[model samples]
Target: MVEEKSDRKKTNTIIFDASKKEPFNINEGYKILHRRLKNSWKVGANRDAIRQEILRTCDVFVLAGPRMKLQDSEIEALKEFVSGGGRLLVMLGDGGEKRFQTNVNTVLEEYGIMVNSDAVVRNVYHKYFHPKEAFINNGVLNRALLECAGKRVDSAQDKRNSQGLSLVYPYGATLNVSKSSVALLGTGTACFPLQRPICALNQRQNSGRIVVLGSCHMLSDLYIDKEENNKIQDIIFQLLTREDIKLNQIDAQDPDITDYTTVPDIGYLADRPFGCLEESEELPSDYMKLFELNLFKLDNVTLPAVLESYEELEIKHEPLGLIRPHFESPFPPLTPAVFPPQFRALKDPGLELFDLDEEFSSQMERLAQLTNKCTDEDLEYFILEAGEILGVFQNSSVKRQATAVLDHIFTQVCEFKKLNQD
Candidate 1:
C-alpha cells in the first residue's frame, strides 16, 4: 500500500546578521520590522560566526551595515547560500570603506555588483536633516510591485502596494551592477548629474535571488517609519516569503579562525569607550586622565561585579549612574592659551612700512602711460595683471592697497574699451 504524502508547506526562516558589528540593533530600533516578520516566519539573530549549516536552514540571509571584513569562509557560505536558492540581501551605507571600514566590494564584485566609496547626496530639497539625506521620488518598480501599486485603495491588493512604492534614500552610496541586473531605483541628477543606480536585484532563473540596497539607513529604526521607508519593510517581507527560493539542510560545522581571531580595539557607535566631550583638545588634561582611569576601571568589571559595585555605591537605577565620575576637578587648572601665537593680529607701527607717496606716484605714472598711449590690448593685459597682483597679496592691508591699484587699472581698461567702441 502507498503511504499518503503530507501537503504542508515548509516554514520560512530569516536571520539578521549581528556578528559583523552592524550598527543597527534589530532587538531595539528595528524591533518593529522584526516583529512584523515574526508573526509568520521564524525571525532571529545570527550572533555567532556564520556557518554553512546555519545558512542551509535560513531562507533569507541579511547582511546590513557590516563594519568589518567578512572571513573567506563567511563569504563562501553566503555565495553558496545564494547558489543553493537562498535569498541574500546586502545593504551598505555611504562612505563605504571609510565609514564601515569593511571590504564589502571583495565579496560583491565577484557577483558583478560594486559599491562606490562616495556618498549619494541630494543638494535639492531633502528631509529636514542634512543634505546627505537624499529624497527619492522616482523609482522604477518591478512588475510584481507595479501590480500591487495599481490596486484599489482599501482592497486586499492594496496591502502590498509597498512593493512598487518610492523610498527615502538616506545617506547611501551608489552601486555598479551588471546589465543583466534589474535596476529598481535611479537617483536624480540634481546633486550628482550622473543619475547613478542605488538599488538593484538579480534573480537567477531558478537559483537564489540577490537584492542590493545602497543605504542601510532606510531600514534603520530612526528613519524607517519616515516618508516611504515602509516600502523597505514590505520588499524585505516579499523577499523572505518567496517560496521559489530554496535552501538545503546540511550537517556542516562552523569555520575555524585561528589566524583571524583578533579584532581591533576601535570604538563603534554602540560601545563608545569615551564621552563626546572627552575627545576635544580644549578639555583639561587632568580631567582626561581621570576619565581614562575610570574607563579602565569600568572595562575590567564583569556584569555581576558591575551590579555588586552599584549596590556598594548605593546609586539609583537612573540613566546616569552615581558610580560614574563627573571627571571635573577643583584643583588649580592650567590656563588655556592660544594655540598658534604667530597668527595673532599684526600691530600698526607709527612708521609706515612703505612710502605711500612714492609708491602711489610710481603706480600713477605706470597707469597713465598704459591708459593713454597703450593700445586696448595693453589695457586688457594690465587688467589681467592687476587681478594677479590682488591674488598675490594675502594680508588685509596689503590686499587693500593691491585692490585699489587693481580697481584703478580695471577702470582704465573699461574706459579705454568704451572710447574704442565710440
Candidate 2:
C-alpha cells in the first residue's frame, strides 16, 4: 500500500511555473487545460522561484509562454529536475525568444531544440480566419503519435499517411530539431514554412524527457477543444507520464521535415532601392567640337526665302505701316449737356382724381344731384347711381339693380313704421 501511494504521488502531480510571469497559468489563460488535467493529476502553480525543492514532487513541470527571462539558477534547476527522471514541457509563441524577452533557449539548446525567432502562417485561408491561425491537416510526423491518439496507422501506405491527425496551430513559431532530438509535429505543406518542425521531444537514457511546443495557446481555454487539439494534448501528457507509449525509431531519426528557409522582406527592400547605374555616351576627343553653337542662334537663313515667297504669293514684304482704325459703337454716341438739361416734366401725384364737392356730399345731396341729372327716360339709371352713392347696394346682398335697391329701402321703411306703431 505504501508503494502504491508512492507511485500515485510520483505520477499524479503537475506543476506550472509562474515565476517568470508566464502568460498561461492554472487560473488564467489555461483554465480549460487545468480542469482537464484535474481528473488524474494534482495541478498547481509555483508562484515563487523555481528551485530543486519546488520541482522535486512534480511529475511534469510546464513553462507556458514565459514572458520574462529565466534566471541562470532557475534554468539549472529545470535541467537538474529533468535529468532526475522528471518530465518538462516548454511552450512559446510566435516571434519566439526575442519577442518574449526570455532566455528559455539557453536551456533548450543543450537538448537539441531551439525555437526560431519567426512565426508560422498559412499560405491560404482555410478553417481559421487569421493567417497566423495555421490549420495543419497533415502535420503529425511520427506514427507513434497516431497510436497514442487512437488513430489508425496504415503501414501499407507511404509515411505521408501518418499525417492523418489535424490541429490548429495558432500564433506559433517553428522549431529547429537536431539529431539528438526527435521532431513530432510540423507546419505541413499548407503553412508558410512548409513541413518544418513545430514540436520536438528529447529523451535521455535516465528516463527523463522534455517536450517543446511552438505555441502555448494551442491548449489554452480559447482553443483547447479545437479540431483534435484535445487529443493531441492527451498524447503529449501520455508520452510524458506513461512509459508504455514509445516513439517510432525510424521516424524519430529522420522526421518528414524540410529545411528552415527564410524569406526576404520585400517591403523593406522595396523602400530602400538601389537602381542600376546607366552608362553614359562616349565623348569625342575635343569636347568643344561637340557643342552645336548654331542650336540657339537667331539666324536670318529663312528670311530671304520668306521674302521671295511673299512676291510669289502676291503679298507685300515691306516694313509694316500703321493704319487708322474705325471704332464702331454698339450704342449711339453720348452728346454733351449742351441742350440746357431738358429735365422730364414732374409726374402727377398718386392722389386720386376726385371732386371736393362730390367727396364731401351727404346721401341726400348725392340723391338730389342724381335726380337733377336724370330725366323720365333715365330714371332706372339714376336710381342705381343713387343707390351706389347712398351705399344701399353695399348694405344689402341683393343685385345692384333699381328694383332691388327700391325693395331694400321699402323694407327698411316698413320696419321703421312698425316700430313707431308699437
Per-candidate TM-score against the hidden true structure: 0.51, 0.66
Candidate 2 lDDT over residue span 1-422, tens digit each: 01111222475799998888788899998998899899999998999988988888789999999988888899899888877788999999999999999999999999899999999999998989999999999898888888888877776755566567899999999999999999999998899899999999988653678999999999998888999999989999998888777788989988889888788999999999998989999989998888898797788889989888998999887888999999888998788877677788998789978998889988889788888888999988987897788678777597888999899878989999999999
Candidate 1 — which pairs collide?
none
- Deviating ranges (above 4 Å) for candidate 2: 1-11, 274-279, 284-422
How many clashes in candidate 2?
A: 0
Q: Model 2 — which ten-residue stretch has the worst lDDT?
A: 1-10
lDDT of 2: 0.88
lDDT of 2 at 96: 98
Instruction: Judge candidate 1 against the unseen true structure and give its global Cα lDDT, from 0 to 1.
Output: 0.66
**Model 1: residues with Cα > 4 Å off, grouped in runs:** 1-11, 141-144, 149-164, 191-194, 243-422
Pairs with backbone N, CA or C atoms under 3 Å apart (clashes), candidate 2: none
Residue 332 error, candidate 1, Å:
42
- Candidate 1 lDDT over 1-422, as tens digits, reads 11223232244888889998998757965787787778887888888888887887778888888998888898888877777677788898987767898887776776677777778777776655677877765543333444333433334643333334556777898777664565556564454424566776766655677788888887877788887677656755575456442211110011110111223546663586654555555666676554656545545547788778778999875597478667768888788886865766779768858856545665556556546765766755666454443343343443434456576657768999999999
Q: Give candidate 2's root-mean-square deviation (CA, Å).
A: 19.2
